[model samples]
Target chain A: MDEIIRTENLSKQYGELLAVSDMSLNVRKGEIYGFLGLNGAGKTTTIRMLLGMIRPTSGSAFIDGKRVFADNHELWKIIGSLVEIPYSYPNLTVYENLEIILRLRFISDKGSINRVIDKLKLSSYRNIKARNLSLGNAQRLGLAKALIHNPEILILDEPTNGLDPAGIYEIRELLKVMAEKLGVTIFISSHILGEISRFATRIGIIHEGRLIQEVDTSQLDKLCRKRLLIDARDKQAVYSSLMQSGYSLSETKDGRFELLDEKAVRNPEVIATLMVHAGCPPTLLHVEEEDLESYFLRTIGIKEDLR
Target chain B: MKNIKATLLPEFVKLRRSGIFWITIIIFIIIPLMMGLMMFVAKNPAIAAKLGLVGTKSSLFGRNDWPGFMGLLLQSLASIGYIGFGFVTSWVFGREFSDRTLKDILALPVTRSSIVISKFIVIVIWCILLILVLFSTGLLMGWLLDIPGLSVQLFLRFSEKYFITSFLTILICTPVAFFACYGRGIIAPIGFLIISLVMAQFAGLIGLGPYFPWAIPGVYTAPAGTEGMQLFLSSYVILALTCILGFAGTIAWWRYADHY
Candidate 1:
């Protein structure tokens, strides 16, 4: 794959503390790359350096074969970014804000503005002040603003942080479209495990300013941790059957049964059959595997208790 | 060129949105009205002498009343206009940084210097508009006070003096503009303005106030006579040098300063 963005030993230090250290990353064109990290894990810091918003103490990064710091104006032209939340002049109408950016970029084609507005479904709110928008609408506006010029590369940090469920789904779908149709390589960093997993083709897990692991979507299922759920008609029968199977279930607070198991069960289907044999009619059975969230926690050495 | 236009157009929009643009216009018109009211009240002899508006009235006022009045008023309020300029510059740039709008702007194709220059031009344009408002107010006041036919010469004289004085103000104010860019919080520009005000006042109290940046505003001060024209010309050259040096220093600092 052709690389769109590459960083070599990129590092940033604030006085005595190293915020980002000796990190190298490669993002190929036409790939939806997920940068997963917990809060305060240096993800924002790294993105800031890439966008030339901060100077790295050492090392270098490249965007479209141009050094990030050396050629910021040209590099930024190719990249659209949302660092935290999108902010504009709160008093200015949506159209005003978009027009300012469009004018600054010297984009005279009115079609570009209309296309992005239509794509993000923001035409109705075009005259509304940015301050009056709800969080979901604001997130959509942020995404639209970032996508307005139809940038070839996008670097978004917590893009859907304050969005509702529908907003989240809309963004996920939008990312998929950009990656598939427009061939716009996206670097999205998020804390939500399922959200990134749904759209990202490749995932980079960062913990404490270090790139702990980089895994493809196909390999994620193998890194699963154990979380089992049992749904049976008779609770007593299921409990007895689990005891007989030598699975020690923990005391649960809710109206459901839960068990914490470090030991791997070879097959979850075995437990389902045991419930039937023990006279509990099986309704639903599910095995929750380790996802991006679990993997991030485990890699960062954050205990399940702390989480 | 293209970059300056791109950067400047948005600043006009920003000024329009902030309401300061119009307020400055209103002040330019309204402040001179106070002077007109003073002239009207001078017609009442009983109150005129107490206010000292009667005896001091001279044939000089009859010779060039409108231009002289407008020049005095504009020069008086020049500090106020620049204070407003400082306030606007600080708010405009500071809000972008605090609200994270700078992040959005930097993501565009424009250069950083253009961003700074665009804002500077916007303030200068606002100053120009305010100067026009001052001239118009002066004309209106003169017409109401029953001064004989107002000619274009009056406007030219008023404009030229204000123009020269404004250039001096801009020179003394270069650092204030730079502070607006460099300062982070809401208080930063205000703090710098206060410091300049104090420094200028203190420098004027002493005899050696020429080298100080704040003394540029007082550069044209001369006893009214043939000496005034000579003083204005020499001082204009010195004021031009001050502006050139201050602007050069600001550009140099901007080239090296880390905007982020």
Candidate 2:
């Protein structure tokens, strides 16, 4: 598998604070790689370094076999990026904004410009100046500008930030289309974990300026921590039965029991039977699976004080 | 050439939208027409004889032709226009950073040098158009006045003098061009013009005004043939230094200055 983006000991510092510290990662070609992190987790700093917007303090990154900052001219030709907030000339209309960029790219072909406009569904709003457009529309325009050059690699930081549900869905579909149909490698930084789970084929989680883990999306099931939650007639009997069975269990305030051990809590019905034999269960026996949220929390080593 | 074209197309489009081009034409045409009307008002024999315009001063002030007055007006306008050029040049780069258009511009495949060079080219073009409009205005006003053989002579002579004068303005205005790019606000560039003026005045007091960038315009305005080639050469030297400094300042800022 060819790595489209590779960082070797890449680090960034602002005065005494380390934004990204000795971090390294690889993004394979033709994959939607999710860069997941909390607020101020150095995702933007890493992306800035990758795009050659900010120089790394200690190390380096490469895109398509060229050093990022050293060979920016060559690297920029293949990579399109939207760093933080997307910005363009406020006075220029959507068409005018794109027209200026198209002219700058030396692409005078009217057909090609029209094609990008149509692809982004910005045809009707083409004449409207960017300042008058709402945030969602501006975001679409930003995405349109990034896609205008048709670069093979996209480094989009918080691409879906501040978007409505429909706009978010549209962006998700656009990313899917770009990755699946166009074979463009997408490196996205987003706080929307559910959307990232749905869209990303590979995810790298960063915390405290370090990459904690990189996992395949399919293995997310194994990464999940499911619970065999038991709600039985006899709460004490159910707890004692599960505890004697060597299953790690936790109790909730509402007289329910939580089986924390993943391997030990496989068969909820068998536990229910064992409770019945022990004269406990006459009503409910349920199992609930852990979601990506819990998995991320665990991977980041944050203990859930579910009190 | 392709890079120049790529850069120029956007700048031309910007000028068109900003209405700076049409505005220049209107001001150039209107200023002279107003002077011609004033000339008509002051044409009576008693008024003309009062200013001692009846004899040798005719070549300098003209009997009835507005070209001479228009030339004088343009000299003032050109000096002022020199500062205007700085504002326009500054806006070319300043607006990009202030309004956050630099990101879109840098993301394109064009080199960074092209962006800066193209704006410099546009400022130079604006200077050329300004000279043309002023000259044409003088010619039109001269035709209206019917100054007995003074029409064509004043038109050509004043045009030639203003043409030479505008070059010195371009040179003296070069530092303002650099200042415009470096300054973040409208007041900063205006402050630069003030500083340039002060520096030129001080230099003049010390007998070094000929070498200062701000003194080039006044150098050309030094009544034709008094100093002639000496004035031209001295102004040219200062202009060369201004160009070198402008280019150096522009390249340095474009490469390293971060847009906040």
Candidate 3:
């Protein structure tokens, strides 16, 4: 399918509160579509709607052109998902948990369970009950279940909620490989924008129950705001000198001068030379690009309001 | 139909591995054993006197005959079955919510309705096996203790009443499963179990046991034509309605509700 996963103005409401509002997006086959939002930004709600765990109040979601609904069991045969924190039957072993998924998926390969176990590197803990496995292992087990069938499309909501730094990195790399080499289409949601940006092919930032921005990962670096920051001895004098040189400088409350001018940031060496010649040589002069987290917040109007 | 078979394997695996299931089995075994102990005590007063409080409780059985023993078995199945069967239904359904695994099953290749039907199937198997355990243990204890009135006719009558009581008790579990899903955890369903038990007692006392869904099972097992314990064909109709509502409600909730 050209658009393996698509939503058309999907909305969910509870009484007066709108959990997801008129949200629409599409993920091409083999693309890792990152869904970024702050806590309670309707990421899970949207995922749930896509999975048909909850019905949309206003619009619809479709997987492989089939409209999602609880009874549309055929659509889920090739789709795998992990929504929110992953949970299994606590008493069942990790192998048994994945075995359950395999059975439900109706895959006849008895050895596929072991293959996923090896794929997730859970061989040692295969026989460990779900309750005894650490949070990271539990997460791996969840991913293992999602990938056991080698689905064409995978939908995950905060799949790395309880993983350590190493675990997160490993999972990110694994997801990248799955999408790049295996040609799996992944739709993953997370509050951590920076992490999702690392591997997501395209990203949609949601805020206040609405999708505010969608951008290609290749273009994300350019979309992040950048500024030329200048700080020197006699800062007021340096600010005055920059103003004298026809630099459109804005003094920040932190006593540093900032320049949003594209030219200044592009040629920062020229600004240093200009500052030294103007009798206030810069002690600190560098370009500051906004991090993904701040860019995410700004895109959502949370960080922008502060400025 | 194929989807149900697929869903059933996981349900059975989960049930098989749970500690609670074994505990339930042990409880089933122990109830009948305790009843047999009471039968033994009633047969021998000298041994009863030496037992003190145990003897006092055993005296509550009223007779040492096969009929009296069957009476105890029927009554115990009603009350204990209420708690036991309800618990099995609760754990089968509620563990999904308590453990937060409900979401994983919802969007599967198997339909939610199939998942629900599979769980009910497991509960049915669990209730039926438990009754068999109780009955088998009761027979063994009766043979070992050699209680009087051990005719084939008595055995057939008691077995038939026991099976019917067990069936009714299992029927009531449908609502328990509904409560488990509606309430979304073991605690809530168990709470509902307790409330129904209390309500059964109240309804039974007011001569309305035949009408209340929870009371109907207990009324059905009320000692083979006991004057006050009359169950009309209408009683089965009411109980059937409760089961239908509970079953349909549970399935609908799974299909339609926003299970966050």
TM-scores for all candidates? 0.82, 0.81, 0.96
Candidate 2, residues B1-260: lDDT per residue as tens digits?
77778888888777766655677667766766766655654555555566564322443344454544655655565556566566566666667656666666664567667777888888788878876776676566656676445556665776667777777676565556566667754456678877777776676666665676776566556555544213547567767888778777876665555433
Clashes of 3: 0
Off by over 4 Å in 3: A232-237, A305-307
lDDT of 1 by residue, B1-260 (tens): 88898989888887888765677778778877866666555444566566564424632232335545565566565566556656665665566665667677765678877877786777677766776677677667868787544578866765666777665665555556566556644577679878876776676566434545555465343224522123434445665675676556555544444445
In angstroms, the error of model 1 at A186 is 0.3
Cα lDDT tens digits, model 1, A108-129, are 9877877888888889998999
On lDDT, the stronger of 1 and 2 is 2
DockQ, ranked from best to worst: 3, 1, 2
lDDT by residue (tens digit), candidate 2, A1-307: 3999999999988889998998899988889999998888899889877876567889999888778762255467667777667776777788887888788877767666677778877889999988888877787788877878788999998887768998788889989998999999999997656779898999999988999899998888887766767777667877787788777778778867777665646776677778888888747566676778777876777846332
**Winner on lDDT (1 vs 3):** 3
lDDT of each: 0.73, 0.73, 0.90
Clashing pairs in 1: A225-A290
Winner on TM-score (1 vs 2):
1
Q: How much DockQ does model 3 earn? A: 0.82
If both were scored by lDDT, which would come out higher, candidate 2 or candidate 3? 3
Query: What's the i-RMS for candidate 1 in angstroms?
Result: 2.3
Candidate 1: which stretches are off by over 4 Å? Answer: A227-264, A267-288, A304-307, B48-71, B147-159, B222-260
